[model samples]
Structures are given as C-alpha cells and as structure tokens.
Target: EDVHIRREVNALYVYAFCLPSCREYLSGSKGEGFLFPWSDLDIMVSKLPPEEISMESFHNDCAYIATTNGCKPGFCKLIQSYAKCDYYSRVEFLQLKQHAGFNVNFDQTIRGPCYSTNFPDGFDCCYALPVHPDSSNVFLRTFKTKFWNGVKLEIMNKNITVMHCVPKGPEKGDDDGHQWLISFSILEQNIVHSLNHVQF
Candidate 1:
C-alpha cells in the first residue's frame, strides 16, 4: 500500500502538454485539412537517445563542444540532457504511451464527424494525442480541438463514453443517418483539497 501511494504521488509530478506554436486560428479558415500550427509539449523523466546510449560518450561529446570557449561542465550537461532526455523522451515515449500522431483535420463542414477521415485535397492536419504516463490511472485526456462554432472538442481514447450518452447501437458501425450528434457528460462536483486528521 505504501509503495502504491508513493508511485501515485510521483506520477502526479510528471507534466504533459500540447502547446500551440502559433496564435493563428485555422478552424474557420479556408484551409482544407490543416487544423492549426502547434507544438506538442510532453515532459517525462526518462532515458537518453540511442545515439547517446552510453553515458560516457554523451558527456565526452558535449563536454568537448562546450570546452571550445571556456565552457563549464554544467552547460555541457544541459545540452546533453536536452537532446538525450527531453527530445528523445517526448518523441519515443509518446509512440509507446499514446497513439501515433495523426494526420487529420476537424473541419466539420468537409469531413463531418468521422475523425479517421482522410485529408481532403492536398491540405493536411497535424494531431498530437497524449496518453497518460501511468496506465493504471483511469483518467484519459481526449483530443484537444478548437471549433469555429464555439464548440470545443475533447476526445477520449478510451471506449468509455465521457459524453453523456452514445447513440443506439453505437458499436455495430451504424451511422443512424444523422451526420452530427453530440453527447456531453456533466460531472456534478469537482474538488481538490487536502485531508487532515489525527490518528495513531
């Protein structure tokens, strides 16, 4: 029990994000498939890049580059860690942790509700789907979408419907002849706080 609680606390510190690269909005634009320009941010404490697999080689290479103009050991460590830890973890970990980055656009006008729909014409969209670092946690963050119609979209990777209610026979691949149907689940109470009590 102690081990489980410790692990949960550690996992809470790990941060993940999908920050937009540009402020420009692509939802209502004339673009066909490109959703928006954004850079996904996912932070995790993990291993180094394969190229820098050995700890010795990484420090040696980075140290040599840094030494050119009176560089310090800490500077070398920063560069080495950034490439080895930051870059590699974000790209590789996501591949294993979440679904592959998708090429899609949420243009409801052209593509309708089918997220798997292909890119129309030559235009393309970039999707950054993040999976929880801790698989044991039942919480999953759906896709982050910004719509032109003021309706934001968050898609859950899990089959469990966070949305209020799924349509009749949603599993058997039935369209129900309706192009658009939206479901929303409302949580009654959301609170975060500390529990303090005297025992023992």
Candidate 2:
C-alpha cells in the first residue's frame, strides 16, 4: 500500500510541474487508490483553444532555417502555413524539467480519446490532442505553440492537439464514410468536474 501511494504521489507531482496551466485531478481506480499494477493512470487535463496558446521567439526565419536545415535542435518547424505559432519537437520532458531546474526521474503516459467519423476540409475541429515526444527516445517531450498579445509567444509542448485525420478501417483506407471523428475529452472533463464533491 505504501509503495503504491508513493508511486502515485510521485507521478502526480511530476505531472503537475510538467503542465502547470493544466488542471490535474483523480478520476479512475488509481485516483481512488484501490488497485495495484493498474493498466493506466487517468489524469484529466483542461484543453485550451488555439487562440489561448502561442509560441515564443519564433518567426518565418526560424521556419525557413528549420526547413532548410531539416528541423535541427534549438530550432522549430511551421506545421501550419497560417498558424500563429511554431511547433517544437525533439525536446523531452526531462529536458524541460532541467530547463525548469528540477532533478527528478519519473515517467508516465497520459492519453485521450480518438474515434472515427466524416471530416470536411477547411473546417476547424478544435480538439486538443496529446503530443508525444519523439518516439526514438522514451524521455523525449512534445509542445504546443501559442501567441500572446500577437507577440511574446508562449510555447507549451506537453498537451496540445492538432486538426488532422487518418485512414480508417482494417485496410487503412479513407473514403469519407464515417472514417473520422473529433475528440471530445475536453467537453467530457467539463461535464465530470461539474459534479459536486460528494457526487464526484
């Protein structure tokens, strides 16, 4: 029991520091502290719209360099042509912790919902997705870019989503017959949190 609590508490703190602006709450069996060797730890993060996020110290020159030089370290890539922010990958959670000046070793994976439906082009789905670090390294991190005041960009790589779709079905095909869906975990979180403490 002590070991389980210790592990959970440690993970919770790491998550808190990793995503300061995100809301952290308990929602599953682990949150209730009733099981050992759990399959997954449920952590709910508040999803913010693209308007609320921005990338700092990024510009066209940065993207040009990244594109020309192939997105090297200390550089960024422009995933969207008209996006107000720049996307930064190849950095890991440990690197961010170091940037924040902390010495701790804990690894956890927080996930969200993905589904299938029909998607239309030029439409803004507005869903927040978990951006995983480069898969090459287990400790690599991901960030979401946002701009503040049309300047002073803030780059947060931990939890951000993009608007994209994938091939659905077994053969991996796309035909627009209910093969895509927009994520709604953020709405679900709002609904769940609305419950009173006793009900929660």
> Highest TM-score among the candidates is held by which one?
2
Query: How many steric clashes does model 1 contain?
Result: 3
lDDT score, candidate 2: 0.30
RMSD in order of candidates: 21.7, 16.3
TM-scores for every candidate against the unseen true structure: 0.16, 0.26
Per-residue accuracy of model 1 over 1-200 as CA lDDT, tens digit each: 44335334433432222123211112211211222355221111222112121122334322111111222221111123334332122223233322433423333221222122233543322222111122101333343323212122212233222221111112232332211122122110000011112210
In model 1, how large is the Cα lDDT of residue 103? 28
Give residue 128's lDDT in candidate 2 (0 to 100): 26
Clashes of each: 3, 14
lDDT of 2 by residue, 49-69 (tens): 231212222233222112213
TM-score of 1: 0.16
Best by lDDT: 2
